[model samples]
Target chain A: MKRSERLVDMTKYLMERPHTLISLPFFAQRYGAAKSSISEDLAILKHTLAGNQDGILETVAGAAGGVRYIPYLGKEHAENYLEDLAVRVQDPKRILPGNFVYLSDILGNPQDLRQIGKLIATRYAYAKVDTVMTIETKGIALAQAVARYLNVPFVTARKRSKVTEGATVSVNYISSSLDRVSKMELPTRALPKGSNVLIVDDFMKGGGTLTGMQELVHEFEGSITGICVLCEADFDKEKLVSDYLSLIKIDQINQQEKVISSKPGNFLTETDFSRF
Target chain B: MKRSERLVDMTKYLMERPHTLISLPFFAQRYGAAKSSISEDLAILKHTLAGNQDGILETVAGAAGGVRYIPYLGKEHAENYLEDLAVRVQDPKRILPGNFVYLSDILGNPQDLRQIGKLIATRYAYAKVDTVMTIETKGIALAQAVARYLNVPFVTARKRSKVTEGATVSVNYISSSLDRVSKMELPTRALPKGSNVLIVDDFMKGGGTLTGMQELVHEFEGSITGICVLCEADFDKEKLVSDYLSLIKIDQINQQEKVISSKPGNFLTETDFSRF
Candidate 1:
């Protein structure tokens, strides 16, 4: 293939498989080009990605050296997206009963998920996250998005036991929103032992669910690398878990008055945006 | 920027926002290039993608016209992937109690999810899928994957009502495994009326869950575009839904003997992969 054609195809191939290394010889063979030419093509890809400040093409030097695409967003892009997301979260229509803010729309959005995924992956790009973990239903999307960007698998913990999952390890945590003890479980083989897990969720009330996931990681003999949520109910009761990050923070939600207020969370300030 | 750099950035940009139109002027301004130069760059992308038969750079005419990147895979690529997937699914270790096969590992895998998502998206690329729908727990990942490729939001139908979702519309379907009727519900605002929804799931024993999703879609006054599943239990009893596609077909799963067998499903034959 010509250099132009190779560049286009190479860019697409690398972007799809983030954090995966592709040897120069493999690209040379695929494009039927010389190794030196393949190196030149990669140089162009690396320079362009760095110029855009949203991605990086890391070159590994050694016998098994290759290029790895790292999905990341600049500080300006992260700040703008989270600020806009916070504003969108403030819509009065999203206020549900009992101070719960409806966020299914945002959780379901693909564009938002992509941005959120890149942001979270950026934080843990070098944290050695073996897998992303989240509770069933709502948190699955966030977990999958981050897992995709990090090029890792994600496991979901179920709220109820099902027959299809074979055997499971259950954990009980306080459901602060419902004010009751709730149980969550993960399949016995879903997560491997000693895996570095990054726990994520769609929403956090008092960090009860986060604690549940943290406990589940402990049960699996895995270490908790980090904890993150799409939204944290900052105005709610005291939190049970600390040392976490959130994309947005809900400060208030008036059900009777049909009003909601939020702003970007600690994720913005906590994240090291100096890399890009 | 040079044409090489422009091509790299443009490819990454278009791939990130599939099915969304980007006008020529927008690319021109972003790259600080002429409209004609932007057109040439897109033409190069279109030609390369067409040659690979894995993507399409569709151009629209007139004042509102632009370009769209449709994520697709060739017939050969689909066949190879499904065949390999079938081999992976036939592992004896995956056989569980009650003749169930353990596939949480594959479902949780990001690479497998990407291929499955692209293949399903290829099938329904032009089907006018307004939204993707799936039941809670296992199917959420598949739903999210397909939704991401189609650039559409996905809604998960919960087995039980949650306070966060507010009002919901419920439906009942037979739980073939349990031989009992079960209820599933989606929030009233989860899916808009008259949407063309594509239902997806991780596994289909008797397709009872799929039927429930179909009923939910109908309850919302939306049309069923199609139904797809990652695996279909062919050795089980009669299927509840006939018009569906599956990537892998499980022919047998003898729990006591610890043997499992599977092969590619009708999805390969059913898909019209003639469009490159």
Candidate 2:
């Protein structure tokens, strides 16, 4: 293949499989090009991605050296996205009953999911995240998006057990929003012991569900590398978990007044975008 | 930017926003190049994607002209993937109690989701699929995967409604597996009226859940563009719905003998790969 053709295919291939190592010989054989030629093609790809600040191509030097694509966003890009997302969240029409903000539309949008996923994946890019864990329903999309970029499996915890999943390990935690105990379970085989897990959710109200997931990870003898939520109810009464990051923080949602206010969460300050 | 850098960024940009058009002038402006140069870069990308049979770059002519990337797979690639997937499904260890196969691992896998998403998107690439819908829990990941490829929003039909979602429209269907009438719902604001929806799910026994989703779509005054499932139990009782495609068909699952048998479904034969 010609250099131009090889560059197009290489960019698509690496973007599809982020955080995966692809040896020079593999590319050389795929394109039927010399090793030196392949190296030059990769240099172009790496440079272009770095210039765009949306992706990264890492060159590992050694006997097993290869190029790995990392789904990352520059600090400026992250800030702009969060700012726009926060503004969108400020729509008063999104206010739901009991001070809950309706965010299912944003959660369901592919473009929004892509940006959110990349942002979360960028934060945990260097962390030892063997598996991405989330509770059932809304959190599944966020978890899958992050896992796709991280090149890892994501497991969902269900509030109710299903026979299809076989054996499961259950955990109970306070449902702070409702002020009641709720149980969640993960399939016994879904996650392996001693794995490093990154917990994610769509919303955090007092961090009850987050705590439940944390305990479930412990049940499998796994360590919690990080906790992240798409939105956090900052005005909610005391949180159950503190070591967590949120992309958007909802400071107020006045159902009676039909008003909502939010801003970019601590994720902006907590994340180090200097990895490149 | 040089031609090489333009090609790299153009490929990445088009791949990120599948099914969305990018005008020549847009690329020309982004890369600080001439319109003719942008067209040449897109041509290289289109040819490479076609040769590989993994993606399609549709070029529009005259005024309002641009290029659109379509996530597609060749017949051979789809066949090989399904065959390999069927063989993997035959593992006796995957058989759970009550003859249910454990497929959470596959659903949780990023690589598997990408292949599955692309395959399903390839089938509906030409259809007017305005939205992708799936029942909650296991299907969210699959729904999001397909939605990402199709550049459409996906809405989940919940077994139970939540206050955060606002109003909902509920439907009742016979749960053939449980042999009981079950209810499912979708938030009123989740899907708009008169949408072209493509329904997807992780598994299908008698396809009760799919039927429920079909009804929910109808309630929204929308049309069903297509229905696709990742796996179907061929040995199960008569299906509730007939117009659907499955990637894998499980012919048998003997819990006592710990034996399972499966094969690729009608997807290969049903899909037309000559669109290119």
Candidate 3:
């Protein structure tokens, strides 16, 4: 293959398996190129990603050295995307009954999912997340997107038990939005003990569902490294959890006036874009 | 940017948005290159993908001239993956009390989802599918994966409606497995009338859920393009739907003996790999 063809194929291969180590010799053998030639090809791929601030290619040195692609969006890119996303969220037609914002359309969208995934992947580029976790229905898409970018498995917490999943581990937490106790479960066979988990959700009104997920993660002998939500209903009366990050913060949703107020969340300022 | 850098960026850009057309002028502006230069970049990409039999780059000429990336996997790739998947599914440990095989691990896997998506996309690459549909819970991931490759919106049929989704279209069908009438619904805004929908699911015992989803699609004045399942249980005495494809077929699951028999299904034979 020519250098140009190799470069295109190499980029796709690395992007599909982020945070994975690929030895130089393996690439040489796969492409039938010399080791030195493979190294030069990678140099171009890494330099291009770094130049755009969308990704990082770490070239490990030593007897066990290789290249690892880290999905890290530059600070400027993250800010730009969040700003655009926030503006999109400000549409008045998205408002729903009881102060709930209708976001199913965006969540079901593949393009939006890609952008959201790349942004979330930026935050956890170095967190060493073993798995991405989310509770069922609304949160599954977010989890899947992040997992794809992070190149890890994502487990979904279920509200009801299903025969297809076999044995399960159950947990209960207060749903602050409804002021009632809610239960969620994970397939006992899904996550192994002592795994590092990143919890994500589509919407966080009072952080109730997120807390339930946190408890479930802990019960499995896993650690909750971080928590993030696509949208946080700031107008909600009370919050059940803190120390969380949101991509877009909904400060107000005026149903009578058909208006909404939102902006980029603390994610932009909190993330360490300097990893490059 | 040099040709090498351009190829790397183009691959990433096109991979991120599969099956969506990007005008030549858009790429030219993004890369600060001329239209002729952009055409060369796409030529290299299309040629590389064709040689690998991993993707298709459809070009539209004339005033709306552009390129679109179609995620495609050849027949050999499908057979190899499904055969390997079948061997893994034969593990007796996956059998549960009611003869249900545990497959949450595969469903939640990113690598598995990517391959499954490519294989299904190859079958329907020319089907003119406007949307991919699946019933909620376990099937969402499969639907999203296929939709991502096809560059279409995925709509989930919910067993119960939520206030956040606004209005919905509901349908009733006989749950063959449970032998009872069951209801399913799709949000009114999820799909457009006169659209072509490709239905997908994670598992199929009697395909009762699929029938319900098909009915809901019809209620919206849409047509069912095709039906696909990740796994189909042949042990079921009767099936409610036909003309469906399965990635793997579970021939048997004996709970008493803790045995499972599975193999690649008719998907491989039914699909036409000659498109490449």
Candidate 2 CAPRI-style tier: high
Candidates ranked by TM-score, best first?
A: 2, 1, 3
Q: Write candidate 3's Cα lDDT for B1-276 as tens digits.
A: 888898999999899888788999998888899999999999999999888888888899988879999888877788889999999999999887766778878888999999998889899999989999998888999998998888888988888767677777899988776789988888787799989999999989998989998888889999999999999999976888988999899999888877799999999989999877
Which lDDT value does model 3 have at B188? 81
Per-residue alpha-carbon lDDT of model 3 for A78-194, expressed as tens digits? 888899989999999888887888787788889999889989998988887999999889889999999998999999999877766778999999887778998999988899999
What lDDT score goes with residue B220 in model 2?
Answer: 96
Question: Residue by residue across B1-276, what tens digits does model 1's lDDT show?
Answer: 999999999999999999999999999999899999999899999999999888999999989999999998999999999999999999988887777788888888889999999999999998989999999888888999999999999999988777778899999999887889999999898899999999999988998888999999999999999999999999899999999999899998888887889999999999999878
TM-score, structure 1 vs. true = 0.98
Clashing pairs in 3: none
- 10 residues in a row with least lDDT, candidate 2 chain A: A95-104
Model 2: runs farther than 4 Å from truth?
none
Looking at every candidate separately, what fraction of the true A–B Cα contacts under 8 Å does it contain?
0.85, 0.94, 0.81
Candidate 3, residue A88: CA error in Å?
A: 1.9
Candidate 2, after superposition: displacement of residue B237 in Å? 0.7
- The residue pairs in collision within model 2 are none
Q: Rank the candidates by lDDT, best first.
A: 2, 1, 3
- Give every candidate's TM-score on chain A: 0.99, 0.99, 0.97
Clash count for each candidate, listed in order shown:
0, 0, 0
Model 1, docking class: high
On a 0 to 100 scale, what is the lDDT of residue B252 in model 1? 88
